[model samples]
Target: MDAITTPQNRFVREKDVEALPPPVATGGPVAWMRENLFSGPINTIATLLALYVVVTVVPPLYTYFIGNAVWTGTDGNACRDEVVGYRVGACWAFVWDKINFFVYGSYPADLRWRPNLFFLVFGVGIVWLLWLDAPKRGLAAIYFFLFVPVASYALLYGFPAIGLRTVGTGLWGGILVTIVVSAVGIVISLPLGVALALGRRSKLPIVRLVCVIFIEFIRGVPLITILFMANTMLPLFMSEGVTVDRLVRPLVGVALFASAYMAEVIRGGLQAIPKGQYEGAQSLGLSYPKMMYFIVLPQALRIVIPGIVNTFIGLFKDTTLVSIVGIFDLIRTVESARVDPVWSAPSVNYSGYAFAAIFYFLCCWGMSWYSMSVERRLAASEKR
Candidate 1:
């Protein structure tokens, strides 16, 4: 009793207790590896396999790229030696030499700046459109609809007073052709797609049947065959002496192909919208167009943005197939560069291909990121 009273007489200081050890550092690298890579036998095996791959593949790649490996400007002796076990890494020098040809194709040397300027303007316009929220979308629409196409056409195929000589589409090459083809296809297909989607869902049987047949017929064939038909058979559809530009042929093919797929994607969106939305609009005496424009489409489009973007990406990549018809897209441009006598090396081919791959990866990745951002923004807006 006496000892208990004495203990009660003293007060403990604030610093008497030590602070708890910091979280046991459970989220650090060591803990992360333990949890993710070495958590169990299966994880351990996976980690080891990944480690094996990194070790086996990465060092050689690093050395091949960064080391003192010669890839181009080899003599006949060296070329023969390479074929007989003197292996070399990628020859980027070839790309350096032939980059202009790849980028501009046969664009007149003096007029190359015209395409470059258009490319810059278009890129800026796209970035501007994408970056701003609640932008003057109507103005942006006008710029897209009225200004950009006319400006691009004028810049690439110059009119007088621009101080730039005219360059025809025939001379377009590299990623430029790919970008143009894809952009035009996207712009044209969207409205056509919406129309086709509406038509397919129309109460009118004739309209629906026609839409169905067009969609199914286009979707049934491979894109390559469609492109071949465009390249070969499209001319016959025109009047005598009415020759279409080669660039126009691929554009037509891409538009038709993309519209079919986009129609299906839009139809999926339309289907996902509740029937009550339609009934509600009808009850309000809203016409079909008004209902779609105001109520049904907005919701449906929000839901299907991902599908639409995925289709866009697919169409973008498919534009490369135009190369088969002799249009010099990015791939074809690189191939053309590879055949250059000055840059003729096996390593150069790989380098050019790698460059094209990087370009494509950047574009596709940007588009995917934009799509995801839009999806998130729409979702948050809905929640609000």
Candidate 2:
């Protein structure tokens, strides 16, 4: 034993490793429910309450809108008990009959194709702006900013070049009026507001003072008063025998009112830019206007896009107020439709309002989606 030399192995490894079993509960619906809805006593109670609310509220809505909705009827009477087996069925027929009014208002029936065509082109342009990228977007923006309004005017009023009959402004109402007012307000307000914001931020005392006064004055006054003043008071100041169109007044008022609020929003963005950004631009030998146009404004606008869109959405909904000044916009058109004695079923009225809400929701939501997409794209570019 003493003479024996031993060689010993020093390394050892496990040959019988145990495989992992699945988790007690993976991240499936069950785990999500547990985490989100029933992780604690408070959460469990909230989830139960919410489920109860849904169970109680949803079925009646479904029954009313879908189960008993009258899809095919010529009049309210047709939507009543004799027709849909119950008078309570929603009178979708009334909405159907007045759909044209909702779209074109009192635009002459024969010449509606013009507005319809204009709508088609405008819609396509909007879709292009939303779905496609700029620089390669074939300038859909140019179409909207330059060609659309002029073309809309010509087509809507009657293009002598095209042999279309002129439709008087007096006859314009319904969604046509709503769209025009909102579009004009949005288009004019943005640039005007940007200018005002810049002026308010200008180093020149006189310019900044003027901007502050105008912005404050506009912001202080009620929009309806502005509309009234634009409609009545402005004419008194005009040269004798000069005429201002009634339709033009509300449009001006809405644009001016919107611009004040928009200026504040843009100003907030401008103020958010760090002082270093301004100094950096100045160090590069950029002039004041050049610094703004090439450097500052873009970043400021990017920062305040949500505010800008919020302002636009407000202006869009505010277009309904034009009804006070006698412009029959979308809501006004619906109001006019409701007065028809033949379609005055209670169900019809509720349906009409719901329809209007749906239209506004679709518009605002689409705009929001577009804004978010643009934000994501810009963020990606900046990261790159």
Candidate 3:
């Protein structure tokens, strides 16, 4: 007990070892470039090629879009390179002149305030629902899903009793039509798709069979075919004197088309869920609906957020297809305005198309970004 038996008693350091600094050559930009860009001959060459392309392309694009762009002009004459005796790029004046048409289509200029208010309400609802920390989310959902629709309809179509004049769907065009179509498709698709997915997975034969048929049938055809059928064939099938709103037919078609695709995405997620999860929910004495709602679906949906967001992005871009059925969406308005004799110029076409591209890009990017944010938040929660 008096003699130490530990290894520490057997040996002792006579002096401390000198500490050396890490190699400077291995810690800076040079090291990073060697590791990432020039790690191998193939990578080095690829990096050089990429740099060349960007150097050659980006500045010219910048010059065209911004450097040589015509910012303020009244008509085609103002943007004409021949008249100006210089090279011109984008004719932004045309876009500015048609901005109202782009936003509201043929919506009466006097009643445009209604659409502005509609946009404000829609924006508020979107912000409220998307802000995860915001108060009263349940009410926000109600406002977005129920009140927004009713109010949007009344505001756009007008209520005579309230002194608003009636405006036909035929007058609707541009971003207004695009938003309506995209919103309807997105709002209707998710729940409908969930039901279809659940039905396809049901033990009951008839429910599963019907869901399969619907999903397969819709997925088999191009979206254009669905729009045509909805626009033309749907009316023939309707009973005499039963008039369907022109805008609504395409809305139904887009919603159904998106729902079919969304069902497949959700079904993929549902299949990814472990069998043990379902069994565990059942073991807890939960009913089928409660098990799915509280246990199965939440996990499945979280696992497939990317797939859901991808479907949403596709649907958002696909709204442009409605223009074929005489619904003047954003692109359609651009096309119409570009050919106008008033604003007609060499650059007008390019500018109009660029504007359309930018609009679509921003909208799609916003959705993609939001989905990624939600995914990151969910991942953090899982870690905790």
Candidate 4:
């Protein structure tokens, strides 16, 4: 009877539709948690312990930084004399009062807007690079690389003919000095480093010798020594009694030191390149300079992006050392700010330092993020 009924219904018999596959063994959050945080009984226990530690640690940090903080008022008394739960909380009031010191140092109060304008222009240049997607990118690059610096310097240093008052480098402190030194170091080091790397690999013996010695000498010595020597002895080389600008001396030292490190980094990348690449360029009748410039250097630079960025970060942080030579980079400026009797408080010092740390971290992280993104994009282009 069943067989007869089935045959009768054969033209249009309905059956359950196939169930969807079980999500193809997804690597979703639940699966990941299971694998990494709860892979075994021991791992689960360890994760719980870590969470406990985090809980224990985070509250105090929050209390120190935010929960007990005083953000208003003009002086240290706002933090100290106020009737509140936390006398020991962060005194961000001091930071706010001395914010200009941390930004422009002793830059003229009225002329502060000039540096502000320079910063705005610099920001625009960076936005052009990272976001604008402008059609005349080559011109934009030229403007950014060449004209921007001139304009910024003129703005900050003041163009007399334009009625801008001249602000000496001595007055340039805080983040302004730090940014200038680091930027100059990074910009000068890269091309100089590339040149040294090429010279080190040159067939000319004297050229190779000079490059090798320069790199080794610079790399072997400490940056502090180089900075000191630049500050003290650079004038000895200059004719008669021509004194170098205090800022210029540090810039020179930082550039030379960073370039030496950069040279080694680039040399390593040059060595990593496949011999076939060089041979292919030669086969195509490219000159030595043409081959290296058109093919070899680009690949080498890409390969050494991490090292280049690392050197840049180091140079940026090292600019703080300029304070030792009587230049007031951000750290020095913050230190000086904390010493002011009006704002003097334990929390004030910490707050100032914390602000500097956040600023530096933002700059370094932005640089790293941009470089990695560029690297991935370039790799994809090559693949296509």
- lDDT of the candidates, in the order given: 0.83, 0.86, 0.93, 0.88
Where model 4 places Cα greater than 4 Å from the true spot, the runs are: 1-28, 35-53, 81-83, 130-134, 382-384
TM-score, predicted candidate 2 vs. hidden true structure: 0.88
Kindly list the per-residue Cα lDDT of model 2 for residues 179-240, writing each as its tens digit: 88988899899999999999999889999999999999999998888888888787788899
Give the per-residue lDDT digits (tens) of candidate 4, residues 25-50.
44889888889999899999999999
Q: Write the per-residue lDDT of candidate 3 for residues 1-384, one digit (tens) a residue.
A: 435767666677799989998766987899999999999999999999999999999998888889988899888998999987889998888899999999899999999999999899889988998999999999999999999999998999999988988999999999999998998899999999999999999999999999999999999999999999999888888899998899999999999999999999999999999999999999999999999999999998888899999999999999999999889899999988898998878999999999898999999999999999999999999899
Answer with 1 or 3, whichever has the higher lDDT. Answer: 3
The better-scoring model by lDDT among 3 and 4 is 3
Q: After best superposition, candidate 3 residue 221: deviation in angstroms?
A: 0.3
How do all models score by TM-score? 0.83, 0.88, 0.92, 0.88
Model 4's alpha-carbon lDDT is 0.88
Error of 1 at 21 (Å): 8.2
Model number with the top lDDT: 3
TM-score, prediction 3: 0.92
Top of the candidates by TM-score: 3
Q: Which regions of candidate 2 are displaced past 4 Å? A: 1-19, 23-50, 81-83, 130-138
- Order of quality (lDDT): 3, 4, 2, 1
* Model 1 per-residue lDDT tens digits across residues 1-384: 677679777677877677777665688899999999999999999999999999999999876665634545543223333563656665656666667877777888877777788888787678766775646766777777678999988987777786756677888888778889999999899889999999999999999999999999999999989999999999999999999889899899899999999999999999999889989999999998899999998887888898898988999888889999999998998877777675555666677887788778888898999999888887788799
> Candidate 3 or 4, higher TM-score?
3
